[model samples]
Target: MRFYGFFRSSSSYRCRIAFNLKGIRPEFVPINLRRNEHRDAAFLAKNPQGLLPALEVDGAVLTQSLAIIEWLDETQPGLRLLPEDATKRAQVRAFAQIIACEIHPLQNLRVLNFVKENYDQDRNGADDWARHWIAEGLTACEAIAARHVRNGTFTFGDQPGLADICLIPQMFSADRFGLDTALYPRLREIRAACEALPAFADAHPARQPDVQ
Candidate 1:
């Protein structure tokens, strides 16, 4: 398997954490997002979406971080990324989607870049945009998780799973944009617990092989 990703991509970071948790090591193919390599024809042939963290397994290419991670959970052995109960699994998926589907797409590189380019927004303006949406989505996530009957060092359970996999990367992005995480206590706590583990720590952006 060949993993196409960028060092600082949050989506790629999520996949990296999943790979570490699954105990599988695939060949690394670095596509520099900063250099616009993802838009290139060759890379697009593999993933027309031209997103980071496209996993080439066997003869097929898998795109989207959440989809790829879910595939890994279903196929790989080890800790389950979602709960066994269908309802509980849906809750975990909701938490993950709050970050992936809601929060991430807004502050993602492409969207933010478009905001800056077309809207003529400065770094401060763009960051302000990112912070506003991140805070909104995170606040929703915190409220939803609080309503759950979950008690653990990690989100949704005693062990880090899908929620933590999605949360950690989003928290990293929040920190990058200088958002105050103290507003979301559960999330901050979960981030701390997740980062302490070797799987999460080793997959950090700073620890990636393609760090620039």
Candidate 2:
């Protein structure tokens, strides 16, 4: 298997975490998003969306980080990223959606670039926009995590799963924007727990080979 990704992309980071946790080490193929490598003909053939974190397995390409992560979870059944029960799995997906769908979309590189280009805003203004949306969305996530927390370490259970996979990368972005995480104590605690694990730590953007 070959995984194409950019080091700083949150979506790519999510895939890395899931792969590590599941003990699956696909060959890392770096795609330089900064240089628009993702837009090249070679990459677009693999992922028409021109996104980072595309997985190639057995000559098949898989795009979209969440979809790829779920595919990994399904293929490797032993280490469950989602709970076995139907309702619980839905709840975990909802928790992940808070970050993946609501928060992340508003703050990803493309959206930030769009805001800067269309609004004539400088980098600082674009960053402020990202910070505002991330704060609002994570405030909601904190409450949602509070309701479902069981093991006191993870968002849903004792072991890190899909929810934690989503949260950690968002928190990394939050720190990049200097967003105060003190308001979300439970989320912070869960992040700390995740960081303690080698799987999560090893997947960090700073640790990636392409990091400058």
| Per-residue lDDT over 141-182 for candidate 1, one digit per residue giving the tens place of the 0 to 100 score | 888766653677788878789999998999999999999998
**Pairs in clash, predicted candidate 1:** none
- Per-residue error at 212 for model 2, in Å? 1.6
What TM-score, over all chains together, does every model reach?
Answer: 0.95, 0.96
The residue-level lDDT of candidate 1 at 167 comes to 89
lDDT of 2 at 91: 89
129-154 per-residue lDDT for model 2 (tens digits): 99999999999999998886765579
The parts of candidate 1 lying over 4 Å away from their true place are 148-150
Q: State residue 68's C-alpha deviation in candidate 2, in Å.
A: 0.5
Off by over 4 Å in 2: none
Error of 2 at 77 (Å): 4.1
Candidate topping lDDT? 2
Flag clash pairs in model 2: none
